[model samples]
Target: MATVQFKGIVKKFGDNLVLNGVDVDIKDHEFVVIVGPSGCGKTTLLRMLAGLEEITDGEILIDNLLVNELHPSKREIAMVFQDYALYPHMTVEENMNFALRLRKMDKAEIASRVAEASNVLQLNKFLKRMPKQLSGGQRQRVAIGRAIVRKPKVFLFDEPLSNLDAKLREEMRVEIAKLYQRLNATIIYVTHDQVEAMTLAGRIVIMNHGIVQQVGSPIEVYRKPCNLFVAGFIGSPTMNFMTGKLALEGEALFFKNEDIKLSIPPYLLSDAKKHDGREVVLGVRPDDVLVERDGEKCSDKVQGVLEVCELLGHRENLYLKVGGMRVLATVEAFFNRSPGSAVTLCFNYKNMHVFDKATESRISE
Candidate 1:
């Protein structure tokens, strides 16, 4: 286990800058995930740390030792790639012990390490199986087992489960999380899936356009997103945004748009005042938007025509058209509503978010 540090890390492919002065730190034995959209330079960042990609500027330190110029083999790190780059000619056990054999380790020691990794990955019964004979999940576990045999100081996984089916991906996520606890190893994983990032990481590093966005625990980032990009990226169903201008009316502050007017919550009063008369974006998650039922009264209400209803077993997703703006709401499945049905929605302002429209940055609480 080792601590990893990226101090002002930058990467470039010719004239195109892939990573723009990114900085982040991972404590020893911490499971940190770097996540973002495609072409965000997350994979490039991981490759730089693994010594596969060059850092155009800044430094990377592992275990307090600068490894900027170190070879990939000498960095004491193992990478499991997206494609599970396994040798078709090798058996599971042979694959796990390949690195050890390359290092000219004793046969007995190599066998011992292979057995331990096999047991940890539950690949004991599949030791003689070839990569082609194994399922997608099993193949991925074998890839992880190969990394574990070296006992690297840090493990880097680049979307290791992306090739698996949905159910298999979910199962592998649990397996990998358990592996983290069992080995207590420092791991840096890169993924574009927020579900994976939120569920597996002790701390998450959000990146966009080659820049680090936010770094925090799952709950911290979800509850307190630093900007519009994070607020939109971190949650399922995505957060809804409405563009409006802040206006002061008597002693109250309101966010007014063409079709909706919402009063700013008390906690945001001071911050809202700073952006008075300026355009702001109000953010509300689908879970916080309630569909009003018969005999129910809500202070903040808006009307929309339901466009689509998707029943997702436990919950439903309602797509609505509110004054030319599209809104998606996730609600309990029991509250059935047909498409084209006009409905009123009530927003829970306690969990609402406000961002400066011009800068796309969150307004402080």
Candidate 2:
């Protein structure tokens, strides 16, 4: 496994620019996932590294050697695509060994590689099965197996699990995670699925508007997002954001909207001191909000009427109208609250995030 590095990479289409001066270094044997909403240049970045799409300008390095002039095959990298791009006529063994055969490896050598890869992927029972005879997950494994047989220095996966059924997608996700460790190969994965990015990556590169937003471990990004796009994008149910004004109520630093007022935690107060009376975006995660009965008193509470309740088996999600905006919060499903009831909502100020209203960048130091 080798490290992949991109220095000052740039990509353009006609008059429009897709990637701008992007510089990232992927360490050896690291499973780095690049994720973003559709058309945010995640695929473009991966394709550039895979030599599928040429960069308009930049340098790409593999194992500390320049590879910008190298062909995809010469780069010694393998790619697995979303479609499971397997040959319909080739048996599973044939599919996995084809690349080696192209290199003029001996027939017995081919069988040895096919056997080992098949065992790793549990594909022996279906070795003779053609692409049509295998399930979607099996086909995906075959695609990966083909790459595995190459013993490539780097592995690239482009939404490889997107076509599988949900259950199958989950199962394949586990397989990919295990395979990464077993191979100990450097991998760069591209996906729009946050769950996949969060679970599979050693570090995640969150992209937006053709720019890299943040690169950090899943928990780091979840706990301390750098900007509004990342803060809102990384969490499920999304972070509840409301426009508010920062103020000082005596010594207390407060974020105040017409209906929602939350005091900034002491840890965050010093950093927010300069933004007093300025409009700020208040961000809080769904799980951090606690619903209380009408008469409860809490440090930072809001009064809102329940507008909708969704029972998601394990949890309850509520939509409430606070001032002109709606807030979504999750609680244990058995809370037994009916819609249209006036309820007091409590939020952990320490867990709150504050962002600049104009820049959409986090202001909570």
Q: Among these predicted structures, which one has the highest lDDT? A: 1
- Computed on alpha carbons, the lDDT of every model, listed in order, comes to 0.90, 0.87
lDDT of 2 by residue, 124-145 (tens): 9998889999889999999999
RMSD of each: 1.8, 2.1
**TM-score of structure candidate 1:** 0.96
lDDT tens per residue, model 1, 1-365: 89999999989899999999999999999999999999999999999999999889999999999999999999999999999999999999888899999999999999999999888888999999999999999999999999999999999999998899999999999999999989999999999999999999999999999999999999999998999999999999999998999898876788899988887766665754566798889888988778764323333778989998888999999988888888888988866667899999877766778899989999857
TM-score of each: 0.96, 0.95
lDDT of 1 at 44: 97
Cα misplacement distance, residue 114 of candidate 2 (Å): 0.9
Winning model by TM-score: 1
Clashing pairs for model 1 are: none
**Candidate 2 TM-score over all chains jointly:** 0.95
